[model samples]
Target: MANVIDTLFSASISRHVICVFLFISLVYTQNTVVFQPPFVTATGPTVTAFLLGNTSDVSLSLRTVSPSNTTGSIGSPSCTDEATRWVLTKEQIGKTAVRIKLRLNQSLHFCGENETSTNCCTKLLCVLEALQVTACVGNTPKASLLVQATINARLFPASAGNDNKTVIPNQVYQPLGPCPCDLTVRVCDIRCCCDKDCASEDLKLFASHCLPGPFGGQVSPDPDYQCSVQTSKNSPDWFPFLCVTSPPENNPYLGLFYHGSTITPKSGPSFQRQIVSAPLPVNMYVQGSPIITLNNQYFSIPQRVLGRCVNGAPVAFLENFQVECVTLLRSCPTGSPLQTLPADLSLKVMSGQGGNVVVHVTDKVVTDLNSFISKNNALSSAAQKLLCENVTLALDYKFFWQGNGITAVTLTRTIGTLISNVSVSLTTRYSAVFLNGNITAEPNSGNPGYQVGKPVIAGTMDNESESIQRAFISIWNPVGDGLCSTAEKKVVLFGKNSTSGCLLPVGQQTPPQCNLLRETVTNLQASLITSTYVAKRGNPDLLNLTDWMNISFVTLNSSTAMEDTASTCSGIPSHQHILVWSLVTGLVEGVPQREIRDLQIRYTLSTWAQDCGGGNSLCEDIQLFPITSSVTFIDIPVITEPPKARFQINFTEYDCNRNDVCWPELAFPITRYYTGEPYSQSLAKGMILVFCFITASILGTPWRQIRQVWHSIAL
Candidate 1:
């Protein structure tokens, strides 16, 4: 293969069939043939450029490429308008001898001026259809190629190849295992529920979109998207479980599967499509109306984001056209075709917070160039933002599952997949459930991306049953890898063998010796997962999830440390103090399952006796906080006020009974009221000294007589 190569459909002279038996020779459709066409491999910093040319009175078409030595797919008429690229197959790696049968299949004749005409030079020569190549960095030991391409931009010539082999000129290329990563703009790592941490019972996640698209599939607009929300999963029946799954490779986009139950993809509901005026923003990844969530489960009307050029700058603009939003969430029996929206419970639509976003949409997807020019007048700078021409398709699908016991759950998100924006998260109604544990994710060798499912009791396991032992969940990556870093190809784990207790350095403590541990990813994917930096959109440092996470846990009277006292949090601060510690717990919520004994302290708020104002106040003193707050953990605000003061009886000094009145009437103080501030005995002593001085000078003796007596005594 030569370097600096370009496809030349030249028309300078006569044509001859040059069948050079160099690497391969094969016949495609009887009408097309492929000579060992010259190809340029990458040389140093420069890569091979396929140049599709146009000449006078001649047109060439590349019919097909039948590889004799390797297996791959080659687009037809690849040498048209612009240079085309090739996507190599995984099977082609490591073979030294490679050849292909290049053929020219179809050509439509075009009218040109006569040979003697003056405008003959303007005759079109060749067209390079959207096809190109990918550059491969040959790795001797591993069959995977480090591929790079330029499909999103124009400054470079292109080629195609799968994880197989192919290269594009001028595109940023870095290998994560065998995958080629590209991020022209930026990715949205939207923080949904977990802030700094999601251990508090008050956590929420929300999403909204107009021109939403389906995951692993194309974008469309039709049926509108909507959702029904239950702010309280306290009933447990409201905690929805999801079974996110995929069929065979024939249907990569169909992941009607998840943690709660097992269902066939065909059994899933079909999406409804319609024509509407106000479409959602384009480029939706997940689509669900009335998103339902619980432990290890989540549902959302996901959509993708499409971008366009504005005044020469590329800006993400939702498809300008209307869309058919899929009804992904199932509606109650009270629903009909016109009433598919969630009927039972609706979210309060908390604007600008907790998963809710305010998006400004415009009609930008104009697939029709003529319509774009005609509709968008000279004033509309968005004319350049043509995303789609016609109406967008609605992603209408419903989710359903029947099970028992509060099922421990899992939501598997594919890491190290093609698209980075595909995300997954879980949320419950305000105060519905408290979460604390660890998150586990890793690649599934039998599958593509890593798994995001939780192991919970389902079917006969009623999700609310005590059988569900609260364990590891939504915590930070146990390995301490960054969000996107561990996300590429890794599995997060949580619970019983909770790492929260382990303090030893990694690899230092033997497995079983630490009680809790983490699993290992395969060699190839591990290479990328072990990196300290989060390589997203080529910016490895894009996100740092070190302190910020949505996974945590809480427990009452919880203890993993041996020396820990039962009164660790239940005892009063001091005998003189009025407060009694009733209990202590670990943060129990989503996936933060660490149990450090040293870090354990008196978790005073959760554990306490009846509200005895201060240390001795009666039960009636305890009450809810009188003030209301706008800030909240989902539906509930900070609350449950303790008594203003407490009291206690003291009889250590003397008789505690006189007339049988055991209270304050007794000789010794029976009951002592305790206000937070203390009275000062030192202040009383200072006051007495000042009073004595006043008495001596003004009341004890006349000023002149006292002075004479004092002088005589001194003489």
Candidate 2:
């Protein structure tokens, strides 16, 4: 019995030693060995430009600098260099590309800390930070020069189970995903207490709350490890025999334990270069991928989903589209009809330092709808007060992007009068503008000529005639009363003809007041015709006839006579018209290039006192009828004299043969006459030919006589 007990104890000790050995081996394999791949430079030269002073292409490169005399492999002691980086003197990020410049022969440095240190630090790797340039003088090419380089070291720590390589989500606390319940822009979702977008005051009024699982779906319940009441069948095999009892907090598996979870799954190559087709070669967006900024954050734009505005909606890459969303404004229940503009929390913008910045700015408390209109207008003070409204009717956004990400955005808002207790729908428009270089001016309608549906570039010429002062051809915008009291300038789009007018209310029409009103309307008409030249391209110095078109202004007197000379006056401004003439220069890639020319602004004056009764004479409370402004684009080509024939034997329709017809319409064999021929002569020739053919056939003439008759008929 003593020998058996000793043998069993020895067997248990052996098993314990074997299990300990396996656990140590697994830890050593995963934590100790750090495998790192070799680094490579980008395929092409970084930036190349043709210097005006030099004939050859001057190029630059970006490269990294390694430690001096380093010989050992990565993660080895001999190759260890913790501080490694390349710094640029200046960096400019444009719409679709980034331009970074470094001084010639700049010093490289190693200053950054290495978080992936295995022994104090991980081994230093190669770096790509350099702008290499080759100078060319006239026809002579110079040797390549390395301008600068950056030193690169390991960035991640050597760890077990591939924990350093796994993708850890940023918003780990929001287990249900970001804003699953927050549907409206700033309004609180119903019964969604977890929604952070809800106001503190608003959330207090909820009748009930929703119950959520632990960690809001982030953690799953593991009944086996949890210390809870359990049935005998579901418990350990000991089943009350040798069972141990402990508090919930003191449970062994209760704190940070994983049973069946795969903390680190098998991973593939970390970096991949995917090739995708795009309109431009520099575009970096892939199909179906979310649009991202340079810092790898998702690029979000304002989107309308299910009739409500969702500000942080992620935009897909390579999507050139426009979406209109209804933006709901909070209405104050008791106070002023206007509510405070809600803060825009969805847009994400970055500055030069690569940090998020707020793009929306609050300038004025109230936006005047009639601010663009002349302050000295004839409309009464009461009528003018009605023009200013605190409502934002339209939002126009222009996004400028490069191949990598969006670089800049422009926002323009149109304000209109907001009425109390009335439902108003806000319209938001989006547009994507392509930028080649650092451009500040508005994008041209077309490159070399004008394109249909684009805003025409109409502006006055500068003193130097080198550039144009841009002025828009706009119509008056209307409001709730359908009056022309809009402050926004609605630009006249090319190929679109529009005529809009509004009633001008008159309070008192004395002689001096009537003259002032006439001047006010006349001045408005003159201001509308502000520009003298229209251009096809952004730059008018191109000197091409199709590039610049002249604009002429003319005034016409109304032909209508006054009803009574004493009571009715005839000085009222009636109509204003802008006649735009455009001709199709040519077709480029199936798109017509319209060369706009001969822009004319015509103003006509008519009688205004006719609206008031002739007996009244005072015209005290009369309102002038609609004062109109119309824009018409004539696309028909102008008629010009036909070109003179260079050689004799003119290609007139009169000298045409049956085989070689001069005119297309008379080319068919059944046609009796050619174009431009005398009708009597053609009829007489046809009769003679028919008579001769019939007589020849009746007399049984030979085929040769018939052929001779055909020739005589031609004569």
Candidate 3:
């Protein structure tokens, strides 16, 4: 009997402790409240609305319920406590923004009857308030404005320590705990979310900045959210982050326009506390299509806008530029002489850079924005007025700078379509190393950026001499490999070749992108490569000084087809004439700039036997033997000298900086190599190696160590 009484006392004590714990959570745990646009459907926006409630109290009984849009009517509001769900209705998302409030009630279970059940305001514990959002409401995108960019939680990656809690991932990310484990931030399928489809119709297209969002949002921990929920299981380093391959193109006819920041122009010229943001506060990200307006007409540059990281820095660029010419008709009146305007559009790459965004060219086309309107006058007047009434943006404009800076106002118009369409190819240098101290680290996995040369490229932002092989084109000329007269030339094949059927090499399997290019360059007989050249950070002293001057600029476009061809592979038959053509053409920069000369066929083989067909007709008896290599470029300014195998460009400091002192090929003494060498490569190499060793021994660079040093420095 005494033991039974003790047990009863213990049970009563446990019940009291439980009630106290629940009370503490109800009273002390703070609540976070916010509003979101309802998911609209064909019928209407779904009533399932969320009132995000985040607290450390961990009381599972709390829920947001009884949602009421004061000015509107909602289907009897209902909720599930576990998920903080509140059912709203289509009527609640009316034209006028509604003021909605949700009751955060903690289910009461009276341990004792007198525990304050007096105030029955549905026992109003707290409120989750929200304002109606108008955007992201329609089931179909009625406007041309599609998704510009969609970012995710990886921006604020979780850690073994305090897994992404404070900032980084925005507040909206925490609403639905569907994320598997905060390992990656899933980019919501905007197409499904906003009913916008920018791809070829009939083919349900879903795309994303994340490698697999279109496939289905990364697998959700919440079974309710169906999709391929990615986890660390796919790849240890795979972290779902924000990315966009090609954002939906805005109305091409509307022309490119900048929705400038909304600001009241120094109201009445009165003193006001400064509100400024620089280096953009957050890791700056701006994405737009390649359509530029000229003379109030939108001309779509036959190019796709894309973002890629080079050396861990983001670069916005355009590629495969297709040219289209059309006359934009002006309408002053019903038949006001059919005022037609001819215009051209071209691609421009703007890298998110620090320091200052300056352009060195004096003659570059400039569009001043000091007194400017947002959209083209060609757009409907009603839309124009609507945009104007939306924001009275303060106007600020200036000339392009001679260095990298995005702070000043830029009109960002388009280049006119010239008769030849030969005036365009721009380069933007991107390096995470430059942003080391200046910008916050924005993580990207698809393009982890080139993994080498950060230390070499860091401090020389202004000096063109400091630039190295940041771009690559894996090119090759096949002699009659009799691969059926087929040649493979691709920078990085994004599409398939109809004739060859093979997807052409993209080299997704190589490390050190330079080598990846070098190893994947399709060869005629044997793969070609350039000799490794050494470069010190900020100085170019190791290679032959003359080679540096005559071909140093060429080094900007340095490339190698097949290296040491004489020693490696046998040449193609004399009858099969070697041909040189461009696989990748630079806009504005013609053949003269990228391909200075045709790469010679250096064919050699190891079999040591010329087992050719008897008459050399069908060649059935002889087995075809050709080795493939990887080169990073097709045709570019190059010096095919044995000791100096590198791609080069004609762009001298003159072209880059517009200075009289730096003329193209001015520093380089052109060396002409005629047909037929007198000596064997072995002898030439032996003598050159000995002489280099002796000279370098005295000059701090041993000829034997040059290769080793460059191997390390390239990183």
- Report lDDT (CA) for all predictions: 0.22, 0.45, 0.25
Worst 10 residues of 3 by lDDT: 142-151
Per model, how many backbone clashes are there? 173, 16, 58
Residue 523 of model 2: what lDDT?
66
Each prediction's TM-score against the native? 0.17, 0.41, 0.17
Off by over 4 Å in 1: 1-715
Model 2: residues >4 Å from true position, as ranges? 1-299, 302-312, 316-319, 323-341, 345-348, 352-357, 361-396, 401-407, 412-440, 482-488, 536-546, 558-567, 617-622, 638-715
The alpha-carbon deviation from the true structure for residue 240 of candidate 3, after best TM-score superposition, in angstroms, is: 34
Report residue 236 deviation for candidate 2 (angstroms).
78
Q: Which candidate is the best by TM-score?
A: 2
Displacement of residue 531 (Cα, Å) in model 1 is 14
Find the candidate with the highest lDDT and give its number: 2
- Which candidate would rank higher by lDDT, 1 or 3? 3
State candidate 2's TM-score.
0.41
